[model samples]
Target chain A: MKNRLRVLRAEREWSQQDLADRLGVSRQSVNAIETGKYDPSLPLAFKFADVFEMPIEEIFLRD
Target chain B: MTTGHAKRRYHLRMAVAMAIYIASLFVADWLIEDRGVTGIAAVMLASVPGLCVAAIFWILARLVIEESDEFLRLLYIRQIIIATGIALTGASVWGFLELYMLVPHIDAYWWPVIWCLGTGVGGIYNKLTMGTSGNCT
Candidate 1:
């Protein structure tokens, strides 16, 4: 999976740690997802969606 | 963060467990030297290391339970599975070598040592493949 998480976070002036704090996860997880090293679960994807206030499809894409 | 507390506690527990393990080793050595591995003394000495191993298991279980992040928990589970596979493979290879008279006999305690090393290998595996080490400590 590919995601615009890094771009979105950058646009929002949020660091990886900031997003991880908001999502109640470790900063490493945010970094992994952003770097495309690990894909988030559905629930976590939804949480990202909720955090970004964007549709899941907008943030994540099929690779 | 939520995980910060849990991570700190985990580290603290691991430190204490390691300290106890080292201390017990000294005690076991002293007992063995003084008592010549008599029945009760031998049992007591053996139990120290046994308890240390059990403590390690308890710590791993506690990590799984205390971790609130599902993704991190999943990573831990994957690492443990890999560690177990490595340990089992090592044991099987060593067993066959011993049976064939290709190697000297090994104590059972070495299995746990190998398993612990496997956990380190698992961490490296995760870092290579997952872009994160997924370290519990």
Candidate 2:
């Protein structure tokens, strides 16, 4: 999966740790998701989308 | 979840557990060496509850990591299984050698065997029953 988390966070001037804190996950996990090292589960992706106030499809798309 | 927080808590518990184990070992040694203690008295006076503390450390470490993720747990399981296989094989070989070739030496070998089994075997038991991968941390 490809996600715009980095872009979204960048736009908001938030660090990975900031997003991780909000999402209740490790910074490494956020890094993994951003770098495509790991894929987030659907529920977690939804949480991310909800946190960003964007549609899930807008934030994540298939590579 | 805070990995840092969880890691700190787990490590603290582990350190304390190790301290208790070491203290028990020291006390056992003191009793055996300085006071010439042996046999069932030594077992009752020291070894039994040392075994129990070691057992409790394994149990409590699991509780400390109860909120950890799947990847970490999987890593721990693999480490433990490998360690146990090594320890058990070593113990069996040593036991066989003593039973066939030596006298009284096998009795002396008990602590090494127990220590290996307690550390690896206990961790294995802890990681297996805890199902560590499904939690929030």
Candidate 3:
């Protein structure tokens, strides 16, 4: 899975820690997701969508 | 939730349990020496160390319960599964070796020690495969 999480976070001017705080996850989790080292579960995807205020499909792309 | 409070509680509880476990070892040794490992007193003395070991497990269970982060919880569960697999496999291999008279006898209590070491292996496995340590602390 590939995601535009870094881009989205950058647009919001949120650091990894900031995004992690919003997502209630560790900064390492955010980094892993952003770096394509990990993929979020469906629920976590929804959480990302909710945090970014965008459709999940818009943020995540199948790779 | 991986809060500071939870981490502190885990450390405190583990420290206490380990202290009790070490103390129970001494007590068990003293009892066996003095009482010759017979009677209800010996059995009860032996159970004290086992109960302290169980308390360590209880601490891990409590950590799992108190962690609210779903991803971290999943990681913890995975680590525990790996630890259990390693411990069981080691025990089975050792049992077979002992049965064939190829190895010396080992106490059953060592299984938990193997499991604890397996958790360290699991942590390394997570770091290698997951690209993160998955350390809740």
Q: What is the DockQ of each candidate?
A: 0.72, 0.20, 0.47
**What is candidate 1's lDDT per residue for B4-53, written digit by digit as tens?**
77677788888998998899888888878765777876888868877888
**lDDT top scorer:** 1
10 residues in a row with least lDDT, candidate 1 chain B: B1-10
Q: Distance from true position, residue A63, model 3, in Å?
A: 3.3
Against the hidden reference, what TM-scores do the models get?
0.88, 0.60, 0.87
Candidate 3 lDDT over B55-93, as tens digits, reads 877887887888666556666667777888999999999
Location of the lowest summed lDDT over 10 successive residues in candidate 3 chain B: B128-137
Positional deviation of B55 in candidate 3, in angstroms?
2.5
DockQ score for model 1, please?
Answer: 0.72
lDDT of each: 0.85, 0.64, 0.83
Between candidates 2 and 3, the one scoring higher on TM-score is 3
User: Which model is ahead, 1 or 3, in terms of DockQ?
Assistant: 1
